[model samples]
Target: MNNNLHIITADTVREILDQYPLELYEIIKNSYILHDQQGSINAPSSFLFFPHRPESRIIALPAAIKPNQEKFNEISGIKWIASYPNNKLKHMPRASAIIILNHPDTGFPMVCMEGSLISATRTALSGIVGAEYLYNKDKSCKSLGLVGNGFIAKHIVKYLFLLGWKIENIHLYDKFSSSVEDFRQYIQSFGDLKITIHDSVSTLIESCSLIAFTTTEKIPYLNDHNLFKHKPCILHISLRDISPDIILDSINVVDDSEHILAANTSVHLAYERNKKDASFITATIGQVVQQKQTIPKNKTIVYSPMGLGILDLSVSQFVYDKVKKQDLKNIENFFPS
Candidate 1:
């Protein structure tokens, strides 16, 4: 057995990603294309719900990608992630995770790394990739709206800046005032982007051309289709925030139909409401990215990405490759020989 396993800490992952931000859009783009080409195996994530605290749950995602023309190395990994919405009261992050990568040929564990940053970054990049194809790039969207002011929302804003989206205003709405204020202070470091705190979701929805939902709602909440005045491109990052009627009224896109439809998400609710019909989902993001489906221009485009494990593997592999070239310390004796 090869004794070359490396343990990557959360601080290391954070430092590497912060220092050398890769072209995540492209990395995620290739991953989606690989997914569309049937070059990847992604098992549906297994969820362990807390009986005492019903809103909190842990999820295990396992996936592998076969080597193809675009990517030469075979990669297989799994991410164990947990989300506790009430963790914010204790001033801790809501989500915590770890990813494990194994040698594709030998099945020996090769790398184990912190995965919360990977999770957030990959999820944010997914939103940006979807927005790239679905939103009208020719038209200038000055205002962006964020429905939740949390860790995932912060990463999404970071990626939006990295992608060079010209936003003149940011409208933020959060249940907690402190969360909104903290997020506001964080974004101020980037530039003098106008940031407004909205009193209600309806106001924020009406104010921005691009809206992202990053809350921890397990059930449907945002249902009013009439509030969307701009035919906004909605990034449904948190899957279950928007109601079924809103889904039916829009042009819906998802990362994977099967995965997103399984967890009582807005799409799943819509499917159940319509008597097990899936016509509400217009196309997968891969199909849109590959130009297999025509992007509609006149309707609200809702993108719901189920947070695939392939993305976690891709980013983890990239970080591992980059970190190997650096002078960083890793856990040498993660396992006994």
Candidate 2:
């Protein structure tokens, strides 16, 4: 284990984004490994045991490789992150977290850093990658239907702007009224964009060419009757926020089929429990980006990413490397040695 540890914070992440190219190559690659790798673990609600409830969730995600790969075992302590949604506090973020990068063999602590930014950026990068493959830029993409208004949602919208997507029309819907309003004010500084708060899920999703579902709901969001009939819509299922019937109808593109099915979110698990086949899935997102297959024309495509550790590790690594280079002479010392 490396003892020369480095920590990064939300401010550091914003600084990194200003110069990090926001490139999707490494993000997309690590996302595939995280989705395909079997040993990765995720328990989203482990923090229910905590006394103070701030809309928090805990995740202990780890990944290891068997000896067969190189006649030796290797594991990584990529992250043990806690996401607490309390950004409303003055000078505080919606999600606050720390990640410990440890030695695979000795189990020694290596680096601990602010993970809220890492988590948020990696999540948004997944959506950006999905958009790159799922949506047709030539067809005049307009208006984005964002389902959840959390930290991750904000990054998704930010990346949409980065891709030259016009946000003249943004429809926001969340379970909490204040949360929706919070997002509206939070994003107003990005650009001149029209924002509307939708009272119903149907109202938010309708008539939008590009849609993103990033909620924490266990079940699908849209009902059977309200399914999108409009072909060629890009559906970025950041979380399991689509109905089983919708999953059944659309050309499903997963980051990894095995990982997504294993996570057992919504219809992905339902289809498995009943022994139903998933032959309709067009292709994995990696395959599409790698040119293994092309997204179908005039079809409602869905890209569901089962947030993976490799993605977390990759982003964390980026933050770590960048922070190490700083002289520590210019910024506040938020992360202690």
Candidate 3:
């Protein structure tokens, strides 16, 4: 074993990504394209469930990037992340994680870094890029609704502002008013539009052509198909928010078919309900980005990405190289000879 392992803290990840949101967006785009070309290998994300604590789960996402991607080094890694829905009540984040990058050839673990920031950042940028291919700005940006105002929603909103997406208003619908207050103040720093907090998801759904679901719902609670009758563009950031029937009715696009199909997500439910008929999902974000597949203009478009592991690896590669040059802390003799 011949490798030194570097440790990247959340503050470091935040500091670096805050300065370069657009660059990270580009990295995610390239990664999707690389994935679309089949230049990457993404294994199914395995989960550690606490049956006693049904609301919490720890997920392990392992993936690799091939040398074909010119912008990033050929590397492989896994992000181990835990999500506890009640953590916010304890005044802590709901999700926490760390990513480990391995030497692509030697298979030595080269870096261990805080992953919650990277996970959220990559997740946000992926949603933005995924929606970029689907939504017509004039049509979809009517109000920009958010279902959950947790950390994920905050990152998505921040990138939307920093990346220069024009918006006239932002309508929010969250279970807790306390959650909205902090999110509302955060929006002020980025400049403001009409910030309305609707009393219900249905009202918010009716008000915006573009809506993002960022909740921690494990099961399908919103089964109302009529809510999306306006044919809105929904960035289903939280995978299991919509009901299976809704998934069946809408035109869906996921990051990867194999990955999302098995996760018991809405689409997965639809897939099972319809007896393995996956015609409802029109394309992966990769195919959409490559212009190989096109989505119809007059239907509800649900871009439900199950948070591909390959994405984490790609962004981790970029972050590792950037911070590797800086004087960050590292674990010496990490790989024993």
| Residue range 122-185, candidate 3, lDDT tens digits | 9999889866789863323658999999899999988887887888889988998988888888
Model 1, span 225-311: residue lDDT tens: 788647889999989988898888889999998898888999999999989999889999999889999977689889999988999
Model 2 residue 223 lDDT? Answer: 58
Residue 289 accuracy (lDDT) in model 2:
70
lDDT of 2 by residue, 173-289 (tens): 898787798889977878677888889877666757688877766555565544477754555555567666667777778766655665447547546644767676678776777
Residue pairs clashing, model 1: none
User: Who is ahead in TM-score, 1 or 3?
Assistant: 3
Error of 2 at 215 (Å): 1.4
| Candidate 3 C-alpha error for residue 315, in Å | 1.0
Note the Cα lDDT for every prediction shown: 0.87, 0.64, 0.87
Model 1 poorest 10 in a row by lDDT:
16-25
Tell how far residue 174 is off in model 2, in angstroms: 1.8
For TM-score, candidate 2 versus 3, the one ahead is: 3
TM-score of each: 0.95, 0.78, 0.97
Name the lDDT value of residue 303 in candidate 3.
Answer: 96
Model with the higher lDDT, candidate 2 or 3: 3
Ranking the candidates on TM-score from highest down gives 3, 1, 2
The alpha-carbon deviation from the true structure for residue 164 of candidate 3, after best TM-score superposition, in angstroms, is: 0.7
